[model samples]
Target: MKFGPIPTLQAKGSILAHSIVCSGRRLRKGVMLEDAHIEQLSASGITEVTVAQLQENDVHEDQAAAELAKALVPDVRAAGLECTAAFTGRVNLVATGPGIVDLQADRLIALNSIDPMISFATVPNYQQMRKGGLVGTVKIISYAVDAEKLRSACALGSAAIKILPPQLKTASLVVSQNANRNDEKGISAIKTRLDALGITLEKVIATEHEIDPMAKALSSLKSELLLILTSSATSDSNDTAPAAVRAAGGQVERFGIPVDPGNLLFLGRIQSRPVIGFPGCVRSPALNGADWVLSQIACGVSLNENSFAQMAIGGLLKEIPTRPQPRRPKK
Candidate 1:
């Protein structure tokens, strides 16, 4: 595409490169200059105007943006995504329901590298999403880009993005509480998190913070998911929560994650149902590693050993006011 200043008489039929006011008329940028516009500019003594002339092989910005968006999410419904109409060379992808972002990093990276004018960005992989949340956006930076470049970007990815919706719908929380600590606050917080992922809290079982009592509670659960929140932090795999999961005919899969606030979290399974041992930080309604694990599991997203190991990066969350023991300790 050609972009530069030209005589007002020669600007007709070209896209206006900049906004201008002449003869009491506001001609916005990207507007196609017509005979009337040129006549007004001429009458206002504006001899020169900037414009963009498209070549036959160039794709308009709006068309390119929409096409790229379609390639990224061919079936919006199936992909759990919805797209806005392309406007001003931009198209936004939104989540159709509560879920987590699923994307092909390599494909998107290659798509972005195709040309500076073509851009695609989205939330991090496995990031939690809400209904109607903005997932990503496609943008064409110039008035038009070469068709070849746009085609390359479109070819790099097809249906490569989606929202992973929840598969687990019911959960039971078994909390171990002491007389000095109130369980109400933790129960409320856990309920809110589960509700967001479409999981119903079937019941809250109050039990002693002991292996035998917690184990009894765990074995009686019938929900698809089980959660344990203890008033005291579980310090080892043989601690109350992990041992109880084992005592209930379950196997503890992982005991520690690299995430700071959620390092004490653990995962186990009884029969076919998944069980999670919550860290104390989960009692507060804040972003934590447990939220990530819960959301992923609820959405049916598999987590390998590497997934827990990788949580170290970007897991240094800000310390909340309610933290019993701060990392640095008081000077």
Candidate 2:
């Protein structure tokens, strides 16, 4: 695109590169200078104005942004995302419902590498997303961009962003507590977490903080997802929660994720039902490793061995104020 100062008489049909006040009216930038606009500016004693004129081979910013958005989300319904109408040089993608943000990172990187004038930004890969949440955005920096580069970006980023909506609609939580302990915080916290993913907590059964009782409770669960929150923190793969899953005829896949504040979580499955051992950090609303696992499972997005390896990469979460100890010892 050609952008520079030009005589008011020669500015007609070009995009205004900057906002200016003319004839006591505020003319916004990106507006196409017309004959009346030029005449008004000339009458107001303005001799020059900067504007951007599109070249034959250039694509208009709004058009380019709209096209890129379409390419990124081919089927809005299936992708579980909706594209807002392109405005100026921006188009936003939002979730149609609660789910997980499944972004294609490699494709996004390639798209951004094509040129500096176009950018696609998103919430990270596998992010927990809620209904009407902002998933991603496409922005064209300049008033116009090279058509060839825009096409390349569109092709490389095709179908690159989507939301995996929740698959499991209901869950049953089994809490283990002593006879005198009637703490409802764990149950409330678990319900809040499940509600965020649009899942219903069908039952909250409290049992003795014992392997046999908890195992029996877990084995009798009929919800799509099963959960166990022990009064004591799970310290190892062979701890109470994981051992209870095994005792319930379930297969324990993993124990003790690497995320701080959530390092004690365990994952397993009973035939078809998935079980999650909530860590002590779940009493707070802050993001933790358990939220990641729950969101992935709720969306039916399975990973090999229900992997905790990926969690370690960005698992150092903000410490909850309720934590009794710090990550490091005092000097």
Candidate 3:
């Protein structure tokens, strides 16, 4: 792209590089200079203006960005994602359904490293998104770019963004309680969380807070996922919840996460079904480590020690100021 000042009379057919005010009328940037525009500028005493003229091998800014964005999210469309039309060399990707947003962070970084003119940004990986949520966007800095560079950037974004639909739609809650089974508040909180994610709470099993009894309850329940809410947080692999999972013929995948407010969370698998030992943080509606784990599980992503460990980067959920204030004055 060649950009420089050109005389108004000779600026016809060139793209305006900058917005200008002439004769009380605005000629916006990216506007193609025509005979009438040149006449208007000449009449307004503006002899010269800056504009960008594309070379034979260079692509237009909008075309380059649109093509790259299209290449980046081709599969996203079929997965219930919508791509907006390129505007000012930008294209935004929006979600069409509620689901988990998965992003290829490494590939995105590499793509951005290719050239400063081409850039892409997206929401954090594994974010729970509602319909119409902005997931990703492509921005082209210059008015135009080399087609070869555009191609190189697009190649790095293959399968870069994905909206994984919720798969684990049903779950059973097994509460380990030594006292009465009438914990309406606890059950209601769990139910509300599951319902918001479109997951059904199929059964609620209340049993003694012991390995044997909890294991028996787990083995008897049938659901896509099992949630074990122990009366106390499990502190070891041999703790009641983890041991119960083992006794129920399940493997404890991970004991704890690095996330605060959810460091007590435990993960296991029983006969290909996922099991989670809920942390005390889950009793509230605020987002925490358990929400992150549950979102990944609902998206059919396998959970293990590495998965739990990887969450430390953005796991400071307790620091978020979304919690309810007990001492606040009522409106």
Q: Which pairs clash inside model 2? A: none
Winner by TM-score between candidate 3 and candidate 1: 1
Ranking by TM-score: 1, 2, 3
Displacement of residue 331 (Cα, Å) in model 3 is 30
Candidate topping TM-score: 1
Against the true structure, what is each candidate's TM-score?
Answer: 0.97, 0.97, 0.87
Cα lDDT tens digits, model 1, 1-331, are 9999999999988999999999888889998888989899999999999899999999988999999999989999899999899998999999999999989999999899988989998988989999989999999999999999998899997888999999999999999988898889989999999989989999899998888999999988899999999989989999878999999999999988888788899999999899999999998898888999999999997777988877788888877778889898888
Give the residue spans of candidate 2 off by over 4 A.
Answer: 305-307, 329-331
lDDT of 3 by residue, 26-73 (tens): 999999899999999999999999999888888887898889877887
Which parts of model 1 are misplaced by more than 4 Å?
A: none
Top model number, lDDT: 1
Clashing pairs in 3: none
Better of 2 and 3 by TM-score: 2
Model 1 TM-score, all chains together? 0.97
Q: How many residue pairs clash (N, CA or C atoms closer than 3 angstroms) in each of the candidate models, in the order given?
A: 0, 0, 0
Candidate 2 minimal-lDDT segment of 10 residues? 303-312
